[model samples]
Target: MPKLQNIIVLRTFAIIAVVLYHCYCPWLEAWNWYKCEYRSLYSFIFETVLVGRMPLFVCVSGYLFSHLYLDRGKYHEFGNFLQNKIKRLLVPCMLFTGLMCLILQLNYVENIVGYGFHLWFLKMLFFCFMTTWLCAKYIHQIKLDIIAICISIIMMFISMPKFLGIGQYFKYYYRRDSRDNGDDAR
Candidate 1:
């Protein structure tokens, strides 16, 4: 398939939103390096972007993943796909998390879960790809997508275990709610 200009634009927008949300939000002091002085304006921008920024990123990712899997046929082989994702996603997350721990003088073992502090999106994407691949390869039915989505909705209401990186899903929802309630628990 030809390059998608619209997806590229959406990605650029998402990236800018993420940068603005992280770099300007004064309330999220744990994540922002330098908080902007205009708290009300930045808070409005932060709230607006928080709703759609990551979902836009994930939508673009799903589209690109579909393009590669169906058009390029690059991900048909399970082992190759796994290796590619590990290289593209997992390796960088591990490296960055380690570097963060080192730079912050944090204990590596205790801060292992802190990998998700900034890098959770990659880990979540890794799991999403694995699940998508399994469904496409084995189930091989259109209705499976519906089923998976329904299950995911149900899963969202329940608490995900705080292990194997699945907890990030719950954390995302929890953090959104907590932020709305003026509780910055991090």
Candidate 2:
């Protein structure tokens, strides 16, 4: 298979693994499958299936971007490349976000938060591509591609904590009224 095909397969598998974990883990809890306690096997499966997926995805993204960099030669075609990338990324993001927002507003869906969370990936990828494009365009002194990749990795690590924190915050706040104590004091 081609490299692009491999990348697509890897990314699709990662996304499927993550989504499956989210979907079925609650069923495992509901069934009391491990005596309501954590198991090493469960931990292993979780780590194998979900924990490493995003790293693989990011690595694939970096590999693809490297190929793009080689093809575009870092200097001449950067603007066109950046514009094409932004259009590809942004158009779908805005359409989906707007559509979901409208559906939630009209139907009063309680899972709007869950549906809307996918936009975070779109936004992050857009920023990553934009940063890579800028480095390719202006910062042509040194090997800026190396700098861009390193910066992307660092940003991903730093952003992971913030992402988890935001998820936790929303998880708590959305269910605040469902708490046993009914304490509104945050």
Best-performing candidate as measured by TM-score: 1
Best candidate according to lDDT: 1
Q: Could you tell me the lDDT of residue 177 within candidate 1?
A: 31
lDDT of 2 by residue, 46-107 (tens): 65546555445555665678666766454247668667766876567567766756764633
The per-residue C-alpha lDDT of model 2 at residue 7 equals 76
Model 1 lDDT, residue 74, Cα:
80
Candidate 2 wrongly placed segments (more than 4 Å): 1-9, 22-44, 71-76, 106-116, 138-186
Q: Report per-prediction Cα RMSD to one decimal.
A: 3.7, 9.8
Model 2 — which ten-residue stretch has the worst lDDT? 177-186
